[model samples]
Target: MAITKIVELVGESKDNWRDAAANAVKEANKTIDEITGVEILNLTADVKDGEIIEYKANVQVAFPVREQRK
Candidate 1:
């Protein structure tokens, strides 16, 4: 049998929402293995002087469950 798990993550970037989403996946890739997919939940940004100062992405990251060996 195979199993997968999902975790929510928020990523921030000064560039854009797309970069913010990519950042989320990049961060997850650091600690997570065999990342199967990603679902973008929400996109928001911080505004300053009527300009976007930062982008934030809410995402669901999915990865497979594996047995640990010691």
Candidate 2:
């Protein structure tokens, strides 16, 4: 039997959407294990003074639920 869990995270980058999504997954991996995949749910941008300041991404991170050891 297998179990899975999903978590939503928002990441920001000054570069682009791809980096934002990648950063979100990378940061999540720091605290999580068995990261199966990431689904990009939404994309947006922050504007400052009529210029795009940063790129933001909403991501869904999926990972396997670890079974507790007896």
Candidate 3:
């Protein structure tokens, strides 16, 4: 049997929401392998002077758990 795990990640981008989500995936890919998918949990932003200054993404990353059978 195969098992998987889910972890939450927060990433930010100054450009757009897409980049923010991509950033989260990119960072997770660095240390995680077999990344099955990503789910956008929430979206948020930082405001300053009555304007959206940055974009933020809350995502759930999924990856398979690798273990040797004993």
Candidate 4:
């Protein structure tokens, strides 16, 4: 059996939501390993002058839990 854990993360990009989502995972990877997947929770955009200036991604990142030690 394997153990998994979920962590929330938010990322933003000037390009698109896809990049934003990818960035979240990329950043998480800096500290986390054994990543299984990511579930996007929400997507939004920043508006300026009635135009979207940035894309935001809210996601739940899943990875294997670290082993416990005594």
Q: Best candidate per TM-score, number?
A: 3
* Per-residue alpha-carbon lDDT of candidate 2 for residues 1-70, written as tens digits (9 for 90 to 100): 7898999999989999999999999999999998999999999999999999999999999999878846
Clashing pairs in 2: none
Question: What's the CA error at residue 52 for candidate 1, in Å?
Answer: 0.8
The candidate with the higher lDDT, 1 or 2, is: 2
Alpha carbon lDDT of each predicted model = 0.95, 0.96, 0.95, 0.95
Q: Each model's TM-score?
A: 0.90, 0.92, 0.93, 0.92
lDDT of 3 by residue, 1-70 (tens): 8898999999999999989999999999999998999999999999999999999999999998888756
Per-residue alpha-carbon lDDT of model 4 for 1-70, expressed as tens digits? 6789999999999999999999999999999988899999999999999999999999999999768847
Q: Superpose all Cα atoms of candidate 3 onto the true structure and report the RMSD in Å to 1 decimal.
A: 1.3
**TM-score of the candidate numbered 4?**
0.92
Which parts of model 1 have CA positions greater than 4 angstroms off? 67-70
Name the runs in model 3 displaced over 4 angstroms: none
Worst lDDT run of 10 residues, candidate 4, spans 61-70
For model 4, the local distance difference test gives 0.95
Better of 3 and 4 by TM-score: 3
**RMSD to native, candidate 1:** 1.7
Model 4 spans with C-alpha error above 4 angstroms: none
Compared with the true structure, the alpha-carbon lDDT of candidate 2 equals 0.96
